[model samples]
Target: MFLSGFYGHQAAVVRGPKQPFLMETIRVDPPKKMEVRIKILYTSICHTDLRAWKGENEAQRAYPRILGHEAVGLVESVGEGVTDLKAGDHVIPIFNGECGHCPYCTTKTTNLCQTYRVNPFKSVMENDGKCRFSTKDGEPIFHFLNTSTFTEYSVLDSACVVKIDPNSPLKKTSLLSCGVSTGVGAAWNAANVQAGSSVAIFGLGALGLAASEGARARGASKIIGGDINPGKFDKGKEMGMTHFVNPKDISKPVHQISIGKGGK
Candidate 1:
């Protein structure tokens, strides 16, 4: 048997700056066609999760919503038409799976597919044009970002499950599903970093480090990382950063160090 919390009627409020997460439980529906049931093992905290919890972007959030996105799990069941994944397959949930046949997916312009419309604002059941999860009392709870990993178990589209090597550590691979993929893909695919080119990364947090790593892996000749924190400088250097610029001290533009002729 699978379990999940269903978000009921709850007032939204931002608790505090650092401590923003509001704990609550809500109901979620079962998987529909092309969806799958996952038994969540681990999930990671992300800035998006914190922001949504804090009500920083409350207008976009639904009440009693499950907020975590980075997650790893084992497939407990598969919906009809899902032939690729089977029961007991270890996978990482990808919130941004685009329908491969869409225009954006065809052009590789964006991963935001047009086919699937799993609304985060409404109860998962309502948006799918049917109900999958309901409170024991029959109330509906919202599913955030299609894959509500904050809960113990979640029903998600098959497109959201990326089957990885079962031997891989779920804890580490979970990070790759969202944060690592976003930062890395942004640098390599979005920015189109050429080999032997100079790259400047704006932030040095996990996303920034991932971007730097992506750039380095692509054979960037010079990778300059900038951050406000002085403590992160050493770690940035160890991560293939050729130069560290503390924006608080540097008066010149960081793009000046770019090896590319055109500013990116």
Candidate 2:
């Protein structure tokens, strides 16, 4: 099967913002224990993708790497000893897999799965913890975020593939793989927002809107949104924002807006 990937020989090399992505053909390795080969169908560009392309996150990145995190695909093959999935099963690739056996996974406090903790810059998908992708000429290429969904196919651990309904739209569901989950999790899982409580959200981007939506879904009494741009205020109001504060127009400090509400 054909696969897609990008390579950067040099770090911090500014390719124009509108630079077109280059595609390459490569062979995918067979999955090892608890691993699966996925035939990717849909992937999306997130802020992280932009940051990586601009080399803004170079410190945590490696050269000649494949970059992608959000994805949805179908299982094309499974590794030995894998039981829960088989070929043809539909799945979503979780950028961060949760190893149920780990203390952090057991607590379910966050998606930071313990067993998969390998430095992306220095590691690839080798069973012995080494690089997996290499050029025909033998130069190694690093795997980005494990999922590498930009490719038409991906090899991922079973922990990273969550089975979902087969009939679900792959393109739309792909969003839930990262952006949707991150935004929702930050509100319910991280902040633990309570129902009928008053809450104020900063920034009105996708994350902020998701937070506001979560609060509204949780029965929050009031949701105040703060943004430097007044243009976003109208959209924020449409998304259940009870109050919109333009930081520039305020006479007093922004912190005072939350005054007497027990906030610092």
Worst 10 residues of 1 by lDDT: 9-18
Q: Which window of ten consecutive residues has the lowest lDDT sum in model 2?
A: 6-15
- lDDT per residue for candidate 2 within 189-262, as digits (tens), equals 77787887777888998778878878887777778888898888878877788877767775655455544342
The CA lDDT of each predicted structure is 0.71, 0.70
Residue-pair clashes per candidate? 10, 0
Top candidate, metric TM-score = 1
Summarize candidate 1's per-residue lDDT along 70-188 as a digit string, tens digits: 98989987776788998899999877766678777788554667754434454353236544444557655556666777766777878778898999987788898778888888788
Residue 121 of model 2 has an lDDT of 51
Backbone clashes in model 1, listed as residue pairs: 5-26, 5-27, 6-26, 6-27, 7-26, 7-27, 28-133, 29-132, 29-133, 30-132
